[model samples]
Target: MSRRRVQTLPRASDDTVIPDPEQRHLLWARGYLYAREPSEPPHPWWRSHELGGRTLHFDPRLELSVARHGETFVAVLGIAVDLSEWLTGLGDIAEMLLDHRLRSRSAMIRALDRVCGRYIVIDGRGEHAWIQGDASCSRPVYYSTTADAYASHAHLLAAVTGSPRHPRFPDPNGLGKRTYAMPGNCTPWRDVRVLTPNTDLCLTTGEISRFFPRSRIEHRDPLLIIDHLGPLLERQLELLTREHRLLISLTAGLDSRTTLALSRSVADRVEYFCYEFPEVREGRSPEKQQDSEISRQLAERVGVTFHTVPMPYRYPEEPLLSVTRANATLFSHPALGLSHLTSGLDDRLHIRSSHFEVARRWFRRHGATQIPVDGKEMARLLTEYHGNEAPFVEEFDRFYALTDFESTEDLCDQHDLFYWEHRAGTWVPHFLAESDVAYENYTIVNARHIYEWLMSAPHRLRSNAAVQRGLITRYWPEAMEFPINGQMKEHFPAQVACAPDRASSRNWSMSGLAASLKQFLRGNSASRHFR
Candidate 1:
């Protein structure tokens, strides 16, 4: 609803106290301040809009004061959450407060333990706090004690400090480049780090607290996990569905398909949209045509109100930069192109089609289960077609080395021995990385993580492969039997018709230029230029 801040100052002695202490003298300070129209409010605040919900009690007579102690100041925060009785199962605010108390032991911890939803607290008495809720994390809290007042939303923080309107004034290069905010989290200013999900912070004694640990869902079975997910997703839809009308970017792909199907199940009405580039259609082989036809037929059969948005393959080069720059914070080049394509729509539920196959292939290739292929050999395979371009080969190696799989491999060795043996264990971390990256890339994000989780849960529950098969069977049963009996004609037709074209001089030239252009545009600008 509104941004809130809690500022803490030292408690002065009875009579002989200096009223104007230097701004630097204060030890701990934090508070919540928010601005919202009396009408449309943001979430957890929206929950309290009615008379039954919590309302802000503004005290005009209360003078804004700062107190100072030796080196530390203490401030207590009282945060209130407004929820109807029906929504209590979704972690009521009071329950969160109680849980915070149990998890945090110190006085500063006790103060933060009371505040629920998304929050950031800094006590002049030597304490700091940050927290978020379970389903949605929309509230943004940022701080900078470098200025006289440490404020929550970035713009407000700037306004209060009389600083420039730049989002990067404090840390010009770093924060400017990182734009997408993951739902349900906080990224404090440069000096103040995140407290992590289900965690709290108490700067007083320089101690951070954990209200909940990462392993809370460790023993959950597929059905139980889905039960949790169904409600969480339902809550998200309910919140987004408020304006009645909704738009979905649908495709033949699984991610968007699942989102469209789910939205159809819940929303009273819906409008489905898709982007069809003529170039893709014009060059389409028989199989590609078949896929496109199937997608059209499926959308029609589902009775969704469908609209096709046609975007030409070519555009002026300058606008490309503007489009890509808009999304630089969230996506890399490949993803930035897609985001630019969807930027024209006003749909509330902007669905994206993403798959984990790329990450899966990377892991499967590198993991022990696969036949051992030396990095040099893979590098050769990747570069042989591009002539003897040392630079291109070097860049390819760097890209592969930078991926999360390199680190995940180490983690797999240490903690996922069972998965390593069973050939199924990299699912959680793999899916998390994939989902987080996708969310960062798109504006309104949705994915198949729920299904992926179901598929990867313990064998006694359901394998991740099973979920994939089930979805395929449930929606497109007709295509299920096509590859039966080793039918190469139907399933491997593309591979059969294809002959590797020898690389021409022009091909080599384009490859070099693409590589160089890519390198030149490194960072956000590069992604925007190409995308």
Candidate 2:
């Protein structure tokens, strides 16, 4: 029952020995990839399921919960919680799928849109097949035009189709520090592309189309949104704890704090941890050091088991990097540290709050009045954060070209949709897939229902984390004892303290006029949410 003990493995003295291309390819090609044809399971560890014309070849290690009826079949690859009935797991969806009301494809999709959790569903009836990922599209479903097939990993698609690697590999040099996920539903391979979130793929015809935001994203009162989100997340955690151990990632930020607060009901079944990377210890960033310190303190006050994972000084070398690259084709230096971060942590669900960014309107530039309408403005906003890299902009242009804006442009800001469908959709899913080789993981907020609720709230409240604050206050107000993201208030001079730092009992003395003037000059008070 004690699962936190660190495991020791043999170390390679020569860290510089790079694996050959073929060996790397083999490593990348390890996971199961589904195609539109019936066939025997590819590996002994793998299993196959014939869904009409579609065949799912997946290792037994992966979760593939299937529900069947006369001619319709539905399989979910991860956890799915049905909010209406307070039901949990894939089997419930299976039973729900058997309902005559959901006999039609549109009816089934509408039902799925109401469910929450990180999962990808494959629905089949006779020869017609449709695939869709979770709300954030964190579990990516990539399709290859050249092979006329869909698989989880791009490299796996290439390996099965005998297609050559895209020139961008090793260094496509895309934006961001953690990974280089090509913008706008693009993957590392030219022939293979990611299936955008809020969209569905027709494996029968290789056609992809939008399925969510079916109506306008209506603005709701903050309390109503939080009321819905609180119980849903709490119930999900309860269901998950009943089956699997959890390793909740904590930090000084509000997102993680929200997750920690919601896990209070299931505290007995979960533990907490924070990374102490070498760079942070060496003073490259004091904020990370504060994160570790705050996380440890929170765990102590909450009476839960916690670990401080010490990371490697330099990037992990050779085999580790190779394997990471194999799974996470678009990776950066920090991904090498995943091995150390996950060491000794196995068979536990790694819960993160990264997907919560959408709730905060992550792409909304500070001091901007309107959203970016086209690819050019979108590229400028992206370049502002990522630098003026031609390649990055060009890739974004391609992503824009591939998107179905006709269906989505009217519902919400295009930037918000971009952050949802492309950035979080493509980047986070591959990161999760890469980490899967080390340990299982999922984002707590990876659900369309939750996102729809969050985005539906008033922008001012959502931007300042009114929803998260309310949830934390509702479940575990003790989490508010510390400042969020190391700051005491949402805006300077504490015009409004989002959450109190009860430990220090510190208060700001600046007047409202001063705070107001400063906020106006700053242009974008939205920046604080990301801090």
Candidate 3:
């Protein structure tokens, strides 16, 4: 890293035309859109290539891809629909989605008229950025202003501009503890902001805008939901089966079974897999072993293949593994202990059910067991973990008022927004990287339109997982023929409703939280590039 002249194309003998290398840095998230006065000649460091109908000017990243349609630009860093051929003729997102030839076009239109993917779209012509990662920002993006340029590569911007990482220069928009792992438009570092799922931002003025799909859609009758969902699910299955050598991550859970039910049409092409792990508690049976059998049975009944990969709860000692684990997750959360599962696989598309829990009233308080929904409760629920309680106390009103202002959305919608925007949205990209050793890419089936549709309908329809259970029965009643989720000896909706798990553990004492903060601050600096 040194100041040097930029190496441009074979320069004319007139060396005066070769401007000095102004600045160069990359965002940590695989791909990025770097704005340089919006009119500067293209940088010398950029390399260009064409995919689908658009062009990408980048090197040095994985999972980042971009394309262009007229003046609108589409860039994706994580999992997204392959619109390369379809988008070559990109026009209005709505019209493109409405095409009779577009696969799953109906579902796409209903789902915000967006291609299902954890991605960010930059409309160069519009001078704005759209983050379409659904409510859970399983994919994440960040941007900051340093010196004279607005940038997504925060650390590099800080470095190039001679700004301190802390002290003199600290987090201006830092996330509170509870919302840290899933922060939206907030980061621990000063001047950097996160792009939560389902939100967007302007490139020039740095003004933020958002699309609230819940307030826009109409709620048809609940029974009609089932009728409507069949085709949407069918479209998803069709898309998955046609392009992917489908690998379904199975478990003895309603989420996966619901997925299994839909995959039945393409059962011949599908393969099911689950992990078999050792028991964690004394005298406890191996839950994963039993779960493996349940998944095997479901696949057998559906007439597809099943494979159980034996996994150890603890991965063996390897120094490099720890460093990579920290960087992959950015030390935001504790390791999930899935190294054993992801370490030995080849790159293949994998699918699982995430974000399904929040779609229903799963997080809402019931009659006597309800959690409070007041300002204090909202602040504590969101910012409690921020190490020091001061930030949480200071920011609670803003958090509470934001959720409270959406008049038409139900309380459960508040719950979903918190998870979708901050928790799931920010967390999943890291989750995928931990398993990058196994798959080239992966996606959650219950992403995007599904979340919007769930939030649009009355909570009662989805409460008790009525829609989920009803959908399962409608599609594959026999899969529920066996006990699931430790609900033994009954054929009733196997993954029936259960009480919510305990709320998050108490926030750390100030000193302890501070220590954790210091640890995270030092995290990325130690790890070498592993992916």
Candidate 4:
């Protein structure tokens, strides 16, 4: 279906309301805090309904609530939260956001520091919008030249502007899959820009600055960092527990084992479950029998309830298309179908640990000790991403320039960032529910503090997920007793990275040839082999 058809489609339900024809002339948000006056005359969709010197607009589907304090304005979405802890005695969230500092003892620069889920804080005085969201970009923040003064949703920008559909810079291969990132804040369209994680773009000065974890791994013992990571995760889960029934997913890998271990503080409060594609797993990479069984054993060990949630192997085509549309086409290939099987999960929120495995990949034994990745391999990956050798190789030099200095001490250094950006940044979002149903989802590692500690830790601590091993030892030492994915690693390894056997596409498949062609016909241009 075309973008216009999506915009014009009648309201499917109360949760999703379509804008009237006239209102859609220029992208605008209504009903939500993003409500604005109709545009002057010709571009009636956007009018001069200025709120404190700024024209407000955001995605209409957002479960947003608006509030004001003095010259500040606040709009929050995704996670339903009360900022009292982060804003205790701090008064209004808007005020704290506006001052960019707090009266409390907390650090000032990280104003939105502990706030969970996707959030946007606006300074009514200067119209300085501090927009931030989860690592998955579930609510992709977009900007275009036509609306150069501010940034909004991707679909909104595409609707109103002549945003050229071109990427100014070169990106890596398999963009929407598990391999590469959006590349230098580039999105599917050159005209529309994605506010990449760690970046905060100011509407007033148009200044974009780093807005992620300000802390790094402390100069502490590896064991100590492991201790710190466990509590840090508990705190995050504790924070989320206020509004969500934690659903800890156990799979055949280390990610789940680590997550479950760290979640010990609230084990009783959480409900553990296992999900797998038994039908789809037939020909290649079938789900291991011991995988779910181990998970059940682990849950029993934790003394928390564990249930195996069955998923469908053959997803109906139309529903898949709807999911594709809802996810903004950021998801393609085999991962798309997996979303259906797991769609029934509700009430319980998921803290996906898929991307966290990248850090651990550093330690696993790969063919001979890491061979420095060559430019030739890099070019090959890029060519595979665009699916066309000509346009891909033409800019191979640009791609090289963009990821310069990528090859460092370890093989992971060669792939970790891209993996984090693409797998976590792109694929993880698709795993989340695309419908209006309010099943909240977040990444296991989006918390800035955790990221800082992990990145700053000595490489040895993170390699082979040495930190996870330490966490498992400190939290759930018995995990060492349970065979992880049929292997008794003295230390925990990926239970099935993407944890919960999210590795549906790990191996290259001949079936991918047909799947890629279907995706192409469905409007995805990413390479066939990469998918």
Candidate 5:
């Protein structure tokens, strides 16, 4: 099960291709070379080959096709669905191409239109090539360039090119760390670059050209937007239900609660899971008890089997290594604790509202700029309430300074899409940042597909804003009604806020400093129990 053995594949050529100690396999055929390391165990169902004038290989579990059409050739990597109906849909697409009823371009578009999962297509003739995918950008696809050729896959490309040892940047560790922290699923090394989702890249005469720019959904009414979402969600739930058992991570929060309710409406005997911290149970606070009670009540109302997992006070040894290896950032105390609590579930479906924050930001940017007087006054009041928390204010300001706060236009510049015809590029950077984090460790089966479909659907700025505003109103009415800004006043009310938990052996000093500073600068004071 070691990465090395799993990455080894029979070479197309007679001579053995020696892999670098750190590098995995780099197989070449046709006009391109495909390389990757076995980061995880090889799935028994996956397949790969260096044939048909092309090198197509994928690790773990993946489904792909490399076929020719007239003078052009196409390579497609698709999600392996478990349902027979879904498989039939895929077979139909393939059959269309074989029957000559759909041309290569038409077939590619048709396939994408029907595919509700993560996919990539590499099409080309001679030395020219192009790549395209659906809007979600769920999968991580990176590439790099060396003196000789361009490569993709962070670990494999870096090891093979020895670019890490170049005089300009002789430290591979530093380069690796930088690449690791990048937000997108794609990071073309130096000369190589990631292709934006909803985009197409063409390579001709050793030069890469962008054929399609990022596209955005047109604005529409809130009800219409929800009408569209309703079908996508229903279809996605139906697809996901193919699993033997469905497990949902339910919280008092609206996102998961809505998902759980919807799933229950469709699936039979769904299992629900909740996590409770010991500190909350032993707390001498009525508010904490009420919060816990609300979650318990919801689970009872759902009328499904429920399991409560108690969070441990301390994290396991080497928490950083575990998190870093998993390619995760932004480790909230509760989420980190839940990671341990839910470690036992092997085939569980984790329906969460982690994307709500991004959705809110998107809504604010598009429309919904009217912050109610109460909300605005509440923000100002809370700002004054915690004004005395200087330490927290100072810390937050420091961290905010380190962040890249450039307008969306500036971010578009980074991807060379500032002037692109479509506004799709505007959201690509954002999607890449969020999707990169979400796909870091999880193997999302149907949820990812649903996300892709949502990304492609048309929506007006107002509609997007409405979906967010409606969600907040429906789920977190208390937060909207109170609109407290300062955490000190919000959590501690009249009492002074206490220092964060810094006694844990797993505490990262830098992280603790950042957290403390965030509270100070934002005029909010609160402590996470797991910190």
Candidate 6:
């Protein structure tokens, strides 16, 4: 199917617009809408369909599919892959799921999370309903209680409800070297709130609560998890390549390398590119230079086509910036202004590295072994970790008060969940929404099943990048021959010593590996450098 932006949509002012006014009347570049008892379409240009008590509105640029069975119905907007049927697409998955006896909205949401892809699922029986987005919330869902509606962008709800901006976030136009995303599930509007990942929203009651981590995370063998992830990533990539031309972002980081390794089987079919900004091109950014250079060298070695695209930082127009401030909290990201560079590649799906940091202990404090006792401590950690100049402690405290983490205290590390739900879920998706004006994006690591495997692996393996290294070796060991982040694998004695040997990964027992790792950590001088 051909995808193109619909620029014919009506527009008023920047404050009145939702996402990208140039795209469509939808929330973002391609967004969905859920309004209860709407007299007409949310916008004159959007196509509206009634689903029981609610009306679903979306632009023709978006993918919308619905399936009904008996009194229950399932509608999915955006792309999704059925895990049970790896080759099946979202439309088939929706119809296939209707055959199953999903007893409640909770059960339906759980099943939808298992389906790997970026999208939002809307399901309900009769007048009662629920809404949730993909794992890691690649497609975000925001709700306004005053408007009694659900949408892709928070600004859309605010504009519809005429909700005044929250006093705390008065200046959305502020930009600096470092800026903070709106803490927790709070939004810029007093009446609107963002839906955190792994949480479900009830349309009828307007209640939000966690539905994941239903049970404690069990420690699993790293090799088993690696084995499971290797095939899943490859199949997902293969499925994507067959349907759409892919432009996978390449870099000198382990995350992007892991993505590259997974795409080895489909390398010939995929196009690779690295963003070459003016800073890197002018030798001002050594790190970005390494990213572009290494990616180019690796692609040349693998005999795949690669391009170094110029990504000059151009300030967005006042009108675009105003609408962006309304839709997203972190407006300082370069992607917000670089849409002009990527908008021409509308036919290719941009794949990038996101949602992989949860396994890397991203939020862990150095030399601190104990977990933070409560939300206040967590807020303090965020302040220090993210270096926020704004007062996030109060927002975090409020968020902690509303969330029920006590129910999941023992399930997994609270810090990891924070990264998954708060960091990646909130930050990454908002950036994606902002960049949606350019080209659609996807990440293979967006699957909840992959996250489960990553989260359940032994801590030592998960934190040290051994799990990722092992997965890469499983698919394409040759890809690792290149240096990662300017450091060769052999130079990092800790990684070389602790990395699971791919040949015998399956033969080693978890307890045996854990014992060896403990001994290695105690004796190795480089252990201090490892996180």
Each candidate's number of clashing pairs is 32, 0, 15, 13, 20, 0
- Candidate order, lDDT descending: 6, 2, 4, 3, 5, 1
Q: What lDDT does model 3 reach?
A: 0.46
Better of 4 and 6 by lDDT: 6
Weakest 10 consecutive residues of candidate 1 by summed lDDT: 45-54
lDDT of each: 0.31, 0.66, 0.46, 0.47, 0.36, 0.68
Which has the higher lDDT value, candidate number 2 or candidate number 5?
2
lDDT of 6 by residue, 276-391 (tens): 77788678988888888888888887678787766656455556556565556566454443553454554677887888888777766342234643565555555554443445
Residue-by-residue lDDT tens digits, candidate 1, 317-388: 443433332212222332323333344543233333333222123333333332233233333333322232
Question: Per-residue alpha-carbon lDDT of model 4 for 1-531, expressed as tens digits?
Answer: 211100111111223434343323112222112322333222232222345454554333334333454434544443423232543122344344434432431243365544435444443333554554544354455655445433444444554564555653323324434234343345556666555454555665555565343332234444446646665565767777775677777886988888887777777788877764555345344455567667777777667878776554433255444433433434333233344235555545666565566565432323212235433443344334334344434443443343342433232244444444434554444345332223445555654445555654444445546567656755666666687667776532223222221123123243543453344324423221221
Lowest lDDT block of 10, candidate 6: 4-13
What residue runs in model 3 are displaced by over 4 Å at the alpha carbon?
1-114, 126-135, 145-185, 214-218, 278-289, 313-319, 330-345, 366-375, 383-388, 393-412, 440-448, 488-531
Q: Candidates 1 and 5: which is better by lDDT?
A: 5
Clashes in model 6: which pairs? none
Flag regions of model 2 displaced more than 4 Å: 1-31, 37-43, 100-102, 167-170, 173-180, 332-342, 366-372, 385-398, 490-531
- Model 2 gets an lDDT of 0.66
Give the residue spans of candidate 6 off by over 4 A: 1-27, 37-44, 172-179, 332-344, 365-373, 385-391, 490-531
Candidate 5 vs. truth: CA RMSD?
15.9
Judged by lDDT, which candidate is best? 6
CA displacement after TM-score superposition, residue 481 of candidate 1 (Å): 10
* TM-scores for every candidate against the unseen true structure: 0.41, 0.82, 0.65, 0.66, 0.52, 0.84
- Candidate 6's displacement at residue 430, Å, is 1.7
Please list the Cα RMSD from the true structure of every candidate, rounded to 1 decimal place: 18.4, 8.6, 15.4, 13.5, 15.9, 6.4
Order of candidate numbers by TM-score, starting with the best: 6, 2, 4, 3, 5, 1
For residues 183-284, could you state the per-residue lDDT of candidate 5 as single tens digits? Answer: 222222333334444444444333333322223223333333343454454455566556434566666554554455345445455666666666676786
